[model samples]
Target chain A: MGVTVLQIFPDSSRSGCLETEKLHKRIMHLDAVQCGMFTVDCDTCYTVTQTGNNRKLHIVHNSETPTTTYAILDTGTKQITLSADYLFDLLLPRLDFMYQSKKNLKIESKGAKYEIGDFVVKIGTVTMSGHYKAILVEVEYLPCHTPALCWSLMREFMQSFMGSCVKPTLPSYLQNRLHDIHTPQDTVQQYVEKFNEIREGTTFAGTQTTGSGS
Target chain B: MAMPVNVPHVGENLEAAMKSQIVPDQEFLLQGSVLDTSLGVVIDRLRGLCDNADILPETFHDHEVVFVLKDFSAMSTPGPASQGVMLRVRRAMDYPDLPYQLRYVGYPELGNYPALLRNCLDIPVSNNVCEFLTELGAKLDHEFIAKGFIMKKGRIKVTVFKMYKMGIGMAKDNLEQMTMSHMVELSVLTTKTDMSVAEDLRALADQLKPLVQLERIDYRRLGP
Candidate 1:
């Protein structure tokens, strides 16, 4: 409802005689309104771009229609000419819709993991590229590794960006591993092994290569 | 880079006379804060007069931009401005220097108070643009009115005479364009969450950048 604009490529001319049959079909169904153009008024013309050359056939209808719709065809170069009506009516609505979807959009990529820090790890991929950005959430490979940095890294790494939805159900044993992983000399691996011994299917962070079945 | 200079559309030998006031080749902000509406338009119509003239830099900002009144009454919140300041403005007719106008209104308004005009000048032009508007108000019935000159190179003088006219055509053009545009493009680069609209518009003073020409004085404003 605001403004309409058009952007046209500078060139498009001729629909050769060889393509006469196709050209006849187009004109029979064109919305040729009565419109006189600028100083150089252009009528609908057919164009055929060959591999090495281009051709065209112009159909000049009588100036019988009211001067309402005119075509400003480019005779020289290839260009993108926008329909005036389409610019304001069609494009504006699209832009408004796009803008509506512009806030707090969320995304996710499951089963991914990330190297959170020097001594910590988490499951997820970087969703954004900013200092305070978060990461996409991920599934666990281990139940332990309760370092606060590990938790923070997990929080950040698990936020993948795309669409938006909210849910709250974190991994189990998180509190226990967080406590043990922060201990002075205890390797997080040893704690993870103990957790795994008790619960054989604890998913862990980081890429682990295994050869055969246990 | 230096801003270009152009002499006024009045008098001969005037450029040489003004050149003596300048330091051989230095740009100067040739201001016209007159309430004279018609006179301002005449000066404005000569938009790129300083295009080829040599204007050495007196200040850091480069590129000389001419200011024209989009609406004179816009300056006064009053009707029908004067032409004297615009005429006195052709000071470059005497000096070989670059020129710039801080306040620009098209027609139907000019400053009414003398004190308001004077106070406009003495203040610094860099930090406070509002002060620039006041100085735009400063020239009405001013001490600098009718005649002015630079007391440089120890009394080398360039005489400036003042006059005025009504700029109706220019005013109509400004207002009409304000009301209707052929087309206006919305910015496509907006992010999903941009809260900067209010700030940018505020900086624009609720006016389109097209309605007025506030020439950039600081050419080399450094990094963030």
Candidate 2:
């Protein structure tokens, strides 16, 4: 089944962004809870399996965490996340891994998540490696799998509080993969783009000193 | 044969029998889901089923944790149906003493009326047994909350349920229902070869009429 999700990005000036207090109050109207996590991607690999579908896996090894090492496997429609040790011990030894992400990004957020009627709303701040980047508000309408059918409803609900932060039309990611099921990979992909942007903005002092011969 | 009106009684050996059970019983089952914009039709059908059969007053509250396993050693089969194997562990909320069951279901194949001939074993396991599957390479899939209302009509087992998707981080209140539509499944489990059972299933399907459409759905064919 497809999930209808709309992501609201902060405005350029941040003036139109909903304040933290207001965000809480808006979410409180739906009676939500605080479900926040600090996720760090230690290693990532993207490869096409023999069945001809693109698959990606991420290994998270954060020391200061209650949970042990784990991995997230994305096959577009379905995202299977399990223990990193299990994947390494049983699965990883056999398959060939492809592209790997070098720079690891840490995202920590404390957001209020609640389901209003049939919709789930998440309003929180996204922090990358200790610096607060932007406020993210996600509204997911669970019932309808087809985005074309539920897009209007999702927009109206999001716009009630987020104002113009949310795009009037379907996001490009959802539009491009309109035929595919919206999995946790969609959310992870957004985080990865932001993480890459952060990585590109800063120059590594060590890499600069140790110049590449090529 | 006439349809039995009484509820199927649980025998004294029910516990002992389940403990020693090993072989997957060769049974024929035809099942489908009902997804309608207005749940009133399905709700009314469920009420009709309740009125016709000897249904228990108590409902089966199921908290199922599904684990999706990928075999890195072998190449995945070339179809959507053969994508991955799923291991489901189910526990009843009311019956904690009752032994939990761990079922491993292979990708269902399409056959006559899309007959899904798969191995379904009911193994008695501890509550924490899922940890063992994870140790063996199974990845954690999304969990869901299902509350089922079971009704028995003669040889048929009718189950109506409301399914909810668990949100990330495992918070109980953070659950989001998959859809407003309730799934209505009609099934019969018998060891003997009975092609006639299909006719019975079809009859039941016909009775539901326009209220609910009970057609075998190939999971692979589902788009998006």
Candidates in order have lDDT scores of 0.23, 0.54
Clashing pairs in 2: none
> Which segments of model 1 are wrong by more than 4 Å?
A1-214, B1-91, B101-224
Candidate 1, residues B92-211, lDDT tens digits: the string is 222335332232211221233111111111111122222222222222322121222112111111112232222345331132121111111111112113323323323332232333
**Could you list the iRMS of every candidate?**
26.5, 19.1
DockQ of all candidates, in order? Answer: 0.00, 0.01
TM-score of each: 0.13, 0.41
Candidate 1 chain A weakest ten by summed lDDT: A2-11
Worst 10 residues of 2 chain A by lDDT: A203-212
Q: Supply every candidate's count of residue pairs whose N, Cα or C atoms clash at under 3 angstroms.
A: 65, 0
Docking verdict class for candidate 2: incorrect
Q: lDDT tens digits, residues B1-224, model 2?
A: 22223322122123333355522343445555666564556655656654453443346777888886565555555643235566688888668887566665444445664344443434455455476556444578867788767776677777778888766675555557788667877766543244466577777778887777777655667888
lDDT of 1 by residue, A1-214 (tens): 1110110101112222222223223322332121211111122232221122221211111111212121122233422122121111111111121111211222111111122222112112211111111222222224334544345333332222111111122233344444544321122222222222222322222212221211
